[model samples]
Target chain A: MERKNLVEMVNIHKWFSGVCALRGVDFSVGYGEVVGLVGDNGAGKSTLIKILSGVYPPDEGKIYFEGKECHFSSPREARMLGIETIYQEAAMVPKMSVMRNIFMGRELARFRVGPLAYLDIPRMEEESMKALERVDLRLRSPHAPVDELSGGQRQGVAIARAMYFKSKLVILDEPTNNLSVKESERVLEFIRELKKQGISSIFISHNLYHVYPVADRIVVLSHGEKIGDFRKEETSVEEITKLMVLP
Target chain B: MRHTLLFTLRRALLLREISSLIMLLVVILVFFALSPLFLSRENVGVVLEIIPELGIVALGVTMLMIAGEFDLSVGSLFAFCPIMISLFVSEGIHPILSIVLALLLSLLLGGLNGFVTLYFGIPSFITTLGTMLIWRGAVLLISGGWPPPFSSALPTAFLVGRMGIFRASILWFAGITVLLWFVLERTDFGNWMFATGGNQVAARAMGIDTGKVKLANFMLCSLLAGFAGVIQSFRLETTLPSMGGGLEMEAIAATVIGGTALSGGVGTVIGTVIGSFLIRIIDNGLVMARAPSYWFRVFIGIATILAVILNTFVRERARKMRC
Candidate 1:
C-alpha cells in the first residue's frame, strides 16, 4: 500500500519575541488518518498547529496541502483552502446561539432583494440541525446559547461545523482539554468517525491515553523538536511518554 | 412538557428587546398617571419633538456599543456639524450644500476616531474622549463661544418643518430607526457586527474583517450624529455652541438601558428605540410634573441602573432555566 501524505510541513521553524518556539521540525498526516501530536508544556505543539492553521506563518518552512504547496497569509485563507482549526478556548462565541456559532463568519445570506440581502435564518437553522445530527449530538434547540453547552458538546459543535463545511484537514488543538472522562471518550469516538469518513485530523493533546486509542499514528515533540513518530503497532504509550519527557 | 414551557418562558424574558418594550410601556403609564397632561396631544407632541435628535444620536451610539466600541466624539461632532453648516451658510453657501459639507466633515471625524484607536491600539473609549474634547473646543473657537443665527424657510421646512403635529425630524428619526433595524437584524453585515463584537479573534479567524466592521460603525455613528445636529439647527433656525454637551452620556445611558452589553456583541435596534423613548419621556414628564430641572438627571441615573439590573436578573434566570 502506498502511504500518501495529505499534509506535509518541511523543516518548520518559528520564533516568538526572541525565544525559539519551534526549531527545525517536520510533520505530516496521511489521508483519512488521525495523527496524534503530543508534547509537554513549551514543546511547540501549539506553535506547529498554529502555523498549520495560519494563526502565524512559520519563519522558515514549506507547507503542502493535498499535494499542493500553499502559502496562507491569514486563518481565513487557510480555512478557504479547507483547513479548519478548532482552538481550545476560542472555538465559538459563548453568547451567540449554536446556529450563529455554526455560521459565524460564513453566514448564508438570502439572495439580494432590492438593495438588501438578509440572513437566511430558516435555512441556517435547518442546516445547523442536520450538522449536529451528523455528529449524533442533540441540542435542546439550534438557538441555544453556546455558553450553555457542556464542554464536550461544544467540541461536538465545532466538529460538526468542520464536517458540514467539508474541510479537508481538521486541526483539533486540545479538543478534549477540559472535558469530562465520558465527554473525552465522545471526542475520541468522533475522531474515529472522522477517519471512517475519509476526513483527516491532527489531534493535539497532552494526554497520551486520550489520543492513543483513536490515533493511527502518534507524533511526539520534546522542546520543539520532533522526538518520536510511531504507528499504533510500533510503539507503546510508555515509550511515547518517555520520548516526550526526555530531551 | 415542563422542558418546553421553560424554553418558551426563557425565550420571552431572555430577549432583551421584549423587556425594554415592557419598560417603555410601564414608564408611559406611570408618567400619564402622574400628569394627565403627559397623555395630551400637545404634550405628546412636545415629547416627540425632544426625541428625534436624542434618539438619532442614541441609535448611532447603540450600534457602536454593539460593535464593542464607543464614540464620545459623537456629541461634539453633533454640535460641530451644525456650527460648520451655519458658518458655511453665513459665508454665502447654499443651505443644502452647507449641510452636505458638514456631513462630509463628520465622516472624517468618524474616520479619525476609528483610525486613531486602531492605529494606537487604544480603547475606543479613550480615543473618542480625546476627539470629543478637541472637537468641542474647535466648535467653541470657531463660533467664538456664540450661537450662529439662521433664517432659511426652505431648509427649515425641508429638515424640521411640522407635518401636522409632528416635526420632519421625527420622520427622519423613524426612517433611520427602520433602516438601521433592518441592517442590524436582517443583513449579513449585521451578523458580522455581532460576531465582531462577540469575539473579534474568532471572527477574524473565520475570515470576517472585524476592523472594517468597527470602522464602518464609527463612521455611521458620526453620520447619524451629524444628521441630528443638522436637523436640530434647522429646527431652531440657529446653532448653539452649548448644544450637544453631555449628550454622549445620555446616548450611552440609553443604549445600556436598551440592554446593549457594555462589553459588546449583544443588542437590538428595537430595544434601543424603546430605551431612547423611555429616557426622553421621563425627562419630559418630570418637567411637566413640576420637578426641578436637576431632578431629571437623578431620575435618569437611577432609571439606567435599575433597567440594567432588571435586564441582568431576567437574563440570569433564563440561563439558569436553560440548564
Candidate 2:
C-alpha cells in the first residue's frame, strides 16, 4: 500500500558529539490524524522533537513537509512554516503580558511602513483576545503578566499561540506531566477539539491512559527503532505497555 | 503582604539618597553661611563648572547600569581623551580637528571594549577595566609625568564651559541626558534593552539581538566618558596623566545615588543628573569646610551600599505584588 505522507523524515540519523542518539529512523505523520508517539525513558523523544523544532540538526536525513525537502537552521524557521512545538518547558517570557507574549517574536506593526513606525498594540490585543476565546477560560484580562496566571492557564496560552499560527501540525510534548487531573482532561479535550478542526497533531506522552483515548493511532518506539503502529481500536494498552518495556 | 509593601516603600523612600539630597542641601547652606566668600560670584562660578562635565559621564554610566553592564574604563577614557585633544591642539593642529580626533578615538576604544565584551563572552567590567589601564598608561607614556598645555586660544578655552551662565561641558551633558531620556522612554531599542537585561534568553527568543544592543550600549557609555575627558582637558587647558584617576568611582556613586539600580533594567537619566550634582556639591563643600577629602569618598561608599539595599527592598516587594 502506498502511504500519503504529510511530514516525512527519511533515514534520519542524529548524534551528539560522539554518542549515537537516533539511528536511521524513519517516521511520518498524516494530515488530520491524532498520532500518539510513545516510548520508554531516554528513548530520544526530546531529541526527535528538538530536531523537528530546529533546536538540533539531523546529521543525516531529509525532512520533507508536504513532500518539499527542507533544512531548518533555527527555531524561528520552523515557526515560520507553522510547525509549532510546545516543549515540556514552555518557551515563553514569564514577565511579559499575555498580549505581548502571544505576539512575541512576531508583532503587529502600526503606522506608515517606516523604520520608526510604532507597534500596533490594538491589533495585537485583538488577535490575543481571539486566541484566548478559543481556549474559553476565565482569563478576563490579556494584559495580565504570564507570571500571574496559573500553570494550566499558562499551558493553555502556549497551546493557543501554536494554534493561532494557522498550524497544520501541532506537537505537544508531555503537556499533562505537571497538570492536575482536570487540567490534563482540559488539554486532552483541546487535542480532540483540534482533531475536529482537521488540524493534525503529534501527541507525545508516556501516560498510556491519557494517550490511548485521544489518539487515532499509537506509534511505539523502543531504544531508537519504531516498534509498532496500531490503530486505537486495534491495540490494547497492556500489549503496548508490554512492547514499551520489553527489550 | 501589606506590611511587606509598607516596609519596602519606607525603605525605598528613606533611601540614602533622601539623606544625600538633604546632605547636599545642608552642605550648600553651610558653605554659604560660613563665609561670605563662599557665596561670591567667583566661588559660585567654580562650583557651577563642576556640574555639567561630571553630570554627562554619570548619565552615560546610568544607562549602562540600566542595561545591566558596566564600563570601568570610562574614567581612564575621560582623562585620556582630553590629553589627546591637548596633544593635538598644542602642536598647532586645528582645535576642531583635534576635538574630533579625541572623540573618534574615544568612540573606537569604546567600541573595542563593547565588542570584545559582548562577542567574546567576557564580562564588561573586566574588559573595560583592562582598556582603562592601557589607555591611561598610553596617555602617561606620551605626556611624560605632566600634561601638555593648549594655546591660549579663547575659543578652545571657552569650549569647556568657560562662557555663559554655565560651562559648555554642563550644556553638553544636559543635552546628552535629554537625548538619552528620549531614547529610553520612546524607542523600541529602549524596551529591548530592559528586556535584554531582565532576561537575555527570552529577549533572544523574541528575536531581539541582545548582544548587539549591549555592545552598542557599551560603546555609547565609553563615548560619553571620552566626551567628559575631552571637556576636562580642554577646560583645564592642561593634561595630567592622572586626571581620570578615581573618576569611575565618582561616576558610579553618582549613578547609584541618583536612583539607577545597579541590578539593572530600572534607572533614569534625570535621577542621574540629580545624583551627579548632589555628588559634586558634597565634594565642593568638603573642600570649602576644611574637612578631609577622604570623608567624601567614605560617605559615597556608605551611600552606595545604602542605595542598593533600598532598591532591593523596593524591587522584591514589587515582584511579590506583580507576580
Candidate 3:
C-alpha cells in the first residue's frame, strides 16, 4: 500500500539571475515518512527546499500541502500551514532566555488591561520546560540564554518547538552539521521521536551515513536536477553516494 | 547552604543595574562627605528639577537603544518643539492648543525619521543625525537664531509648580517611567521589541514585523523628547535655541550608565531613570563643589565607561560562579 503524501512539489522550476537552480523537479514526502535529500554543493537542493518552505517563489510549479494547493509569500505563511523549517544554526535569538526564544513571536497573553495584554510568563516557562524535556535536553533552567546551550541542545530546542506546535512536516536543514558524534545521535533520536508521533520530516544533509540510517526513502539531486530516488532497503549507501557525487 | 548563599549573592550582583546602583550610592556619599550643603533641601530640590527633564527624554532613548536604534534627532526635536509651540502661541493660539500642535508636529518629525530609516533601509543613526541637523537649522532660521520669550500663566503654574519638594516635571517623569516600565515588562509589543533588537533575522523568521516595532520606538523617542522640551520651556517661559543642545548624548549616556546595552535587547526603564538621576546628582554636586562646568561632561564620559566595564565584570563572574 502506498503512503499518503503530506507535501507534494510538482514540476518545480526556479531561476536566479538567468541561472537555473531547479529545473522541472518533482518531490513529495509522505505522512510519517523520513525523506533524506542528499546532494553536493550547487545541486539545487537548497533552492528546492527554500521554494517549498516559501522562502522564494518558484518560477514554475505547484505546491500541495495536505492535498491543498498553496502559495506562500513568506516563511510565516508556510508555518501557518503547519510546515516548520529548522535551518542550520537553529535560528534563535542568543540574548533571550530559552523560554522566551521558544515563544518569541507567539507569546501567551493574559488579563487584558485596556489596550495592553500581560504576558503569561508562568505558562510559557512551564511549557518550555516540558518541550525541552521532551527533546531530552537537560539545561540548568528555562531562564538560561540560548547562547549558553550546546549546539545539540539548541537544535533540540528548535525541534521541541516544532513538536510542541504539532507541525505536520518539519524540514531539518543540516540538523547535525557541526554537532558532536553523540549530539548527532541525539538528533537521530529526535527524528525517531517525530516518526513515533506520526509527523513527517525532510532530513537534508551531506553525510550519507547520517541520512541512510533514519531515511525511509532517499532523493538525490545533481547539477540542478533530480538524479535518483530510491527506497532504503532497495538502494545501497554506495549507490546513493555515487549518484550524489557523479553528475 | 553556603553554596546557595554564594549563588544568590552572585545572581543579585550580576544584574546589569546593580553596579550602577552601587556607583550611584558611592558618588552620593562622596558628595555628601565633601560638601556640607550637598544634602541641603534646596540643593536636593535643584537635582530633582533637572533630573525630570533629562530623565523623561532618557526613558524614551532607553527603549529605542534596547530595540537597537538611535535618534540623534531627539535633542533637535527637544529644541524645535517648544519653539514651534511658542510661535503658535504668539500668533494668538491658546497655549493649550499650541502645545497640542507642537506634539503633532513632533509626531510628524518622528514619523519622517522612522520612514527614512525603515523604508530606505538606512541606519537610524545616520537618518536621525540628518534629521537632527535639519530640525536644529530650521529652528535657527525660524527664530532668527535668538531665544524667544512667551509665557502662559496657568500652563506654566501647572507644569512647573512646586509640589512640596518635588516639581510637577518630576511627577511627569516618574509617572511616564511607571507607565513605560509596565509596558516594557508586561506587554507583547515589549517582547517583540526585544526580539527585534536582539536578533532581527530570527525575529522575522518567527513571523514578527521587526520594522514596525522599530518604527513605533522611533516615534516614541521623538514624542518623549518633544514632551520634555515643552515642559522645560513652559517652566522657563522661554524657548532657547541652545536649549537641549548636546542633550542627546547625555540621554544616551544616562541609558548606558543605567545598564542598558548600546547594542540593544538588554535594558530596563527603571535602570535609565537611575542612570539619569545619577548624572543629574553629579552635575549638581560638581556645581556646588565649585568644579568647572566642563567637569560635568568629563565625569559623565568616565561614568558611562566605568559602569559598562563593571557591569560586564559582574555578569562574567556570575556566569563563572554558576555550576
Q: List model 3 lDDT by residue over A1-247, tens digit each.
A: 1336998899999899999999999999999999999998789989999998889999999998888889999999999988999886537888888988898888889877875679999998899999888877777789998888888788888889998898999899999999999989989989988898888999998788998899999999888899998999999998887777784
User: What lDDT would each prediction earn against the true structure?
Assistant: 0.87, 0.76, 0.88
Cα lDDT tens digits for candidate 1, B1-323: 98888768877888897666777898888888889998999998998888999899999999988888998988898899999988887888887788789899998889889998888899998999999999999999999999867646326776678977789888888999999998987778888889889888878877888888999999999999988988887777778988899999999988988989999999988788888898899899888888887888898898788889899888887777753
How do the predictions measure up, each by TM-score? 0.96, 0.79, 0.97
| lDDT by residue for model 2 (A112-172), tens | 3333335677777788989977866557678777877776677788778877877888888
Task: List the TM-score for candidate 1's chain B.
Answer: 0.95
What lDDT tens digits, residue by residue, belong to model 1 across residues A147-187? 88888899899999999999989999999887889989998
Chain A, candidate 1, TM-score of 0.95
Top-TM-score candidate index: 3
Interface RMSD of each: 1.4, 3.2, 1.5
Query: Which segments of model 2 are wrong by more than 4 Å?
Result: A1-6, A30-41, A85-90, A95-104, A107-150, A156-222, A228-240, B1-49, B65-68, B90-93, B152-165, B254-278, B281-291, B318-323
Candidate 3 has an lDDT of 0.88
Question: Best-fitting candidate, measured by lDDT?
Answer: 3
TM-score of chain A of 2: 0.92
Top DockQ model: 3
Q: After superposition, how far is residue B301 of candidate 2 from its true place, in Å?
A: 1.8
Report how far off residue B108 is in candidate 1 (Å): 1.6
